[model samples]
Target: MPAGSPKVPVKFDKVQKYFGPVKVLEQFDLDVAPGEFLVLLGASGSGKTTALRILSGLETATAGRVVIGERDVTNILPKYRDVSMVFQSYALYPHKTVAENIGFPLKVRRVAKAEMDSAIRDAASQVQLGDLLDRYPRELSGGQRQRVALARAIIRRPSVFLMDEPLSNLDAKLRGYMRAELKHMQQALGITTIYVTHDQIEAMTLAHRVAILDRGVLQQLATPAEIYNDPANLFVAQFIGSPPMNIVRGGLEGRYFLTNGARIDSPVGGHVDKAILGVRPEDCAVVAPENVALKGVIYTTELIGDHTLVTVEIGHDKLTVKASKDIHGNQGDTVGVALRREHLYVFDAASGQRIR
Candidate 1:
């Protein structure tokens, strides 16, 4: 989206989809503001990709409407929807040069040769592919191929950008590089973007807001920080973090979480026969095993550069503790885990719902 490129909102209103006997999206509702970067995040079979496809007119919704800006585009053909999509596959033309590939969108609409060439160069330059415009897809690296796809999408100047795991093909390092380029490019262009990915890193690093879905249902939608810090349910709490938020099966006794004969105080108060106490690895401290509520033998230790992740076996469950990088511990060493009450989360065991 260049300086005056159209910026529009997107919405999915009470959307539902089913594949014969199996339901996909159930009452899915989401609203994306104008020029906002929204990421649809979920694992495979979560229906995230299906929702995106419906919006792009590639897959028709079983029920409900898809709105782009002020128009109800549920029945519109893709080309007439005024939206651009970049798929997991780069989808570049093998026989076409980068310039020709990028300018293809305009060429279809019969833009003048001079204008098409200018637009192609502008789009290529935006993705830092200017110097390689004459190269064919075969000559470009994975990242370059991705950029060509991006440039192709850009030349359309569509009202919305739809990307489906666009960088999944690249190597890890290249993926990271492209993620940065994508964030920068999106910010520069200010296009209303709807990106779909299973990678939480991409969802966290690139989105203005994230819509987390599970089993075709939108689990939670919020800013990445909010979703990370205050997950809506047990599923979200466990799904978000790397190494993940630790779940200790327990019962609630007053303000304490009772687990394996250990009574730990928590910030939230509730009582349930079957409950779970959730805490992030970083929230627990490793200390000397002396009259502590949690004393465990070290199961394993991993030095993850910035921190040493200590896995402590407390009874039947294990808790991961983020300790100092230089911390020393061997297998079966007894240690104490000190948990701060403020960081603990309580959830219902039966429903997997967060207990306020």
Candidate 2:
């Protein structure tokens, strides 16, 4: 760990939030290890931002407790909690120079000028903004402005770092670069960080562990590989993948899945009137139409650099098969989809739970 202040664990016990009659978070429970990067991931209105606000003391939880390093901070003032937040909007003074913006935190605390200047230089160096200190916010680029905001946040090195989609405003290429910068800074600072983002790529690449939420409820919390390979339910299965996992409605018969007029073998055995079969694009292949259990007309073929995604229309559903880069196919070509049984995921249609 990088040399810094002592790191402390954070906990949420039965946290609940409500705006009038609308429930945003219901008995939210999570534990973030000391000096760990945890990402809260979900779609819009999924209660991710609500939870972060609650932790930051900006929005109080309707019930439960928020603990930081064994201190009950649920009712503490936001400033008193010793946490710094980085907002999606670059919250910087337009007239303030980079050094002034970074040193503003210390200025508020009335630190000595010499100590404050030293801290500002240290923080700016961490974010690679040492050369831009004399420039005003308007003189900097989007990424530079973001780095200034980050420097302001880390200038204090509080117990925990709260970042709410800090990179969302940047373009794709810049976002990628900033993600690397954020990860490196966090590791070097050894600060406990809670980052919130709806972008799966960000969560997957940056978080030590991702906590996926939906409608104020945490669906699953696990490493990226575990969450991808063994999703807790249908929501996570569909949400995490880039192109999303393909779902086929079918009936389960013993160890087989029956869709349309075809019967396909599954790894898990179960009998149900309704079932959903999920297979990722990378786990499926396009084959000759006559020999497979599922055959359909190719709806479209998308060449995505490294591979070709062939979407086959099987009755009412379409399955995207990840084929080689050189694979050739037309829009209306007849093709068969071969799903690897070991990689298939079966979900109970009524409950949305995975069938192990």
Model 2 residue 215 CA deviation (Å) reads 0.4
What TM-score quantifies how close candidate 2 is to the native fold?
Answer: 0.98
What tens-digit string does per-residue lDDT give for candidate 2 at 1-356? Answer: 11355898999999999999999999999999999999999999999999999999999999999999989999999999989999999899998999999999889899889888889999999899999999999999999999999999998879999999999999999999999999998998889999999999999999999999999999999999999999999999999998899999998999899997999998889798899999999999998988797999999988889988889999999998889999988989988899999999999999999999
Cα deviation of 118, candidate 1, in Å: 0.6
How many clashing pairs per prediction, in order? 0, 0
What is the lDDT, from 0 to 100, of the residue 116 in candidate 1?
84
Candidate 2 residue spans exceeding 4 A from truth: 1-3
Candidate 1: worst-modelled 10 consecutive residues by lDDT: 1-10
Model 1 has an lDDT value of 0.92
Clashing pairs in 1: none
